[model samples]
Target: MIWKEILIRYGELSTKGRNKKDFINRLRANIRHLFSDIAPLEIVSERDRMHIKIENDEQYEVLMKKLPTVFGIQSFSPVAVCSKELDDMKKLSLIIMEQFKEQEITFKVEVRRSDKTFPLESHEIQREIGGHVLRNNPNISVQVKKPDVELRIEVRQDAIYMMAQIIQGAGGMPVGSNGKSLLMLSGGIDSPVAGYLLMKRGVRLEAIHFFSPPYTSDNSLEKVKVLANELTKFGANIRLHVIPFTEIQVLIKDRVPSNTIMTTTRRMMMRIADKLREEIGALGIVTGESLGQVASQTLESLTAINDVSNTPILRPLIAFDKLEIIDIAEQIGTYETSIQPFEDCCTIFTPANPKTKPKVEKVTYYESFTEFDELIERAVRNREVYKFPEVNQVKDKFEGLL
Candidate 1:
């Protein structure tokens, strides 16, 4: 009689088997957190399915728009709850058939009875529902194999659920489901894109940005925040840690040969980033480095930089070309913000003829001269932290709209 339920589907969680309960529990908690603002809705979990219910209809549309942006869900549908009796099911079927009259719709009834005592089998219920709907509305055809609208009916112990529409889900494992990584987020075209891809694959990311104030303007720092905000649309509300790198950068420029400056600076960044990663419990470090993209991204430079970090270094865009990465950047809505003219740490003190390939020994020798340990410790100590709001906060702001 009423559309009061939301059905959730999991693409990869199906494989979790015995440990599925933990994953489902985590997902349910996250969903509860996500919709914390919409008070009338309740989230429920079962052995095979997840259901979200609403005491009022007002919150449904808002949930429809927002839940698709969440990371853990594969797909969801807004469903009606009604009596399992044939007459009630037929009435609802006619309403659904009438609603989609404009399109050349091929719909079918998909039924499942958790309480097997229901007299009819799933297929028999499907056929019976199909006949009832056909009798009421003659225009819509029935396609058992491939239907534009699948009217799903579930006969539970206490209630019967039926729904006609399925909304596409974000379709990935949950962020933090995979573990944590420290992304080296520069306000650049590639790094945010790289960060987005890693986050898409269930990696919870915290960002590390090197800032050289007076060298890199405050506007540039703001740009990174803006970029992180945009990434929040994809469920990565990253904690950005800004490191002071002006002195270390200046020392690198002065002590290292001009051609080797980029390479030397990158290696130092790897060391500093690794230290911070350990301090913060990050399992690995992520970078925007793409193969052969620039001088410092050359194989030799990448190898030298990799040598410094004891933790795993994840370069999501390592194999992607500029065009390929840009396509993804545009798809994720970061391309526009990334193109803004804001300098990042790498642009500070850029050498005209930076080395395409520098030896590790040379980079090591340069580091040995200065108090490298002291500089890294100082930079980490002077770090700035930023956090984003939880789902409840989002609701607090948008409750009136709901």
Candidate 2:
């Protein structure tokens, strides 16, 4: 490949004034972590844009495939480095344009002369290079407004770079720049989609999954693990905390009134999640509770759940329709796995006639009969923690006897 560097443009990060450097540093760190398994790289972060110098075609190919998945990048270009000489610029421009040789292409030349001391002005360089390409290639025509192909040239202090394509990036602030949160991940379609949206907004995540054995099978737990692993593709590795919730779930089912059981159960989950959030130093709790999608997601039910904790409850898909949530789940590659036939704790014990407008006072009175504080503490203590995108310890166990 002729391109020697990948130019990255920061999208929302550019709007940050004094904190710009912090965001940029965080982005650079994320890029480094994302590409750690690949060859060593020289990632240069600048005031306006960042560049990853391409060492070979292999590195370029890998970068092109993976870079778009990273947040904070608005767009990127594969740039061909050239000398300051006009002849060198012209020759390289023709070489770059050869990709569109046979087709009739509307093209324009854009030049950014960062090195003001360069002899030619920005327009001068554009004209010189543009004139060269038109003279040589008969199929290429110049169009100023939204050209089909734009040959962008940047005359920087060290070297001049040129490219024809600007690929769109996953635009947002860098992950972890906003802060950290604990995602109340469930073995369902909506929770994974909720996690994706939060990560897109630069919130780092550690997931909490409730598990109830016998009531919920191992397959159900595996499904949640798969979802958490799938989510790691968007940003950094996620630590999935699996809480042993069988005792608490059973107590709620036996003690609470049948109609208001869902509300009480959800409140218990909130209390446990909030406790874990505090333990892990998370700022808030994230859930996939879309408004009115289920009995537990109604305004009254959400308010009842909210009363368990003072910490913020972030419901990213609160207003989204079911179809809208599914579309995002499909886009992020979690739909197929999430649709697997597995019964999670929430679904396994779903009430026959759950109260849509459950009274908080009534649910509170019913839950007061059960001693839940000790069970909640024990569940959090016996939780299983696994880091995603890494080999799970349970999966690595030797089953056959030696």
Candidate 3:
């Protein structure tokens, strides 16, 4: 009488050759984790497709809204199951076509018979269901080339499944399928977008933020937390490491030359991130550096900063233009929060004239005057970690009072 199941079709996982099963298993786990709160449901994953059965109407409505955001799914549809009888098929087909009774539309009926022992063939079943619906609804017409609406019916050993709508899914490999990385997340529009791009490619993320107190307010730290929480919707939980950078920033401003201070600051951040990456077992470091967007993102400047670490540096927005990055930021819902008037550590002691192209030898020579290894180690040791989709402890504290 109503839809009782959801059918999921695979996207890139089908072409993985021998690794298809592992990818499917990972996707199944991710879906289970995403829907852990919704109970009384069954998820059955097959070689070509997956099916989730739900008995409650409210839960079915929730699935419809959440299934589209899940990666690794090419498309999905709500399915109505019925007994294998000619009269039942006809009645269900008529009920499905009743929605378009008021408007003129072109429609087609497609059927797949997994059970070949059925009395009618695929074509015969299509004609039977198609004819029944055509006779009942005068506003509907048949167009085999490309119909406005397509009703797909599948026959199996257990029952018959019917679906009339197919919704598009977020197509990519599931998050955490590739590997884990450390993202240098700042309170900026581009870094959050960069983390999102890596997550789409199946990379699990742990974010690192540099907080300089007095120079950076508590609201700045909260802004970074908000960005990390926004990213959790696209993948698994993110562990955010907030490094104390006030000492390092003050030291750089005092010892390093004004023209090349930006380069030294960036290199220090990379060194800290690389150390944290090794401690946490992350394979690479991710940043939102767009080429030529600012002085520090140029080829020469990037090379000077990258010399501090041997880890693979991933810059997803390297070739992207500023407008392009902003467009993606808006699409993923992080644009508004990133535009808040809060200063990060990177902006506090910024020089009016920074080196757009500085040699690695010269920057390294300037940084050698100050002993940074001790401070770098100290910053990493005193870092604070926060987990995203943070649990609300305030509600628990007031439970007894209420």
Off-target runs (Cα >4 Å) in candidate 1 are 135-139, 390-402
Off-target runs (Cα >4 Å) in candidate 3 are: 98-104, 392-402
TM-score of predicted structure 3 = 0.94
Model 1 lDDT on a 0 to 1 scale: 0.80
Rank the models by TM-score, top first. Answer: 2, 3, 1
TM-score: model 1 vs. ground truth = 0.90
lDDT of 1 by residue, 222-259 (tens): 77876776777665467889999999999888887888
* Model 2 Cα lDDT, one tens digit per residue, 251-353: 8889988888788888999999999999999999999999999999999999999998999899999999999999999988899878887888888678788
How far is 386's C-alpha from truth in model 1 (Å)?
Answer: 1.2
Candidate 2 overall Cα lDDT vs. reference? Answer: 0.90
Global lDDT of each candidate: 0.80, 0.90, 0.90
Q: Which structure is stronger by TM-score: 1 or 3?
A: 3
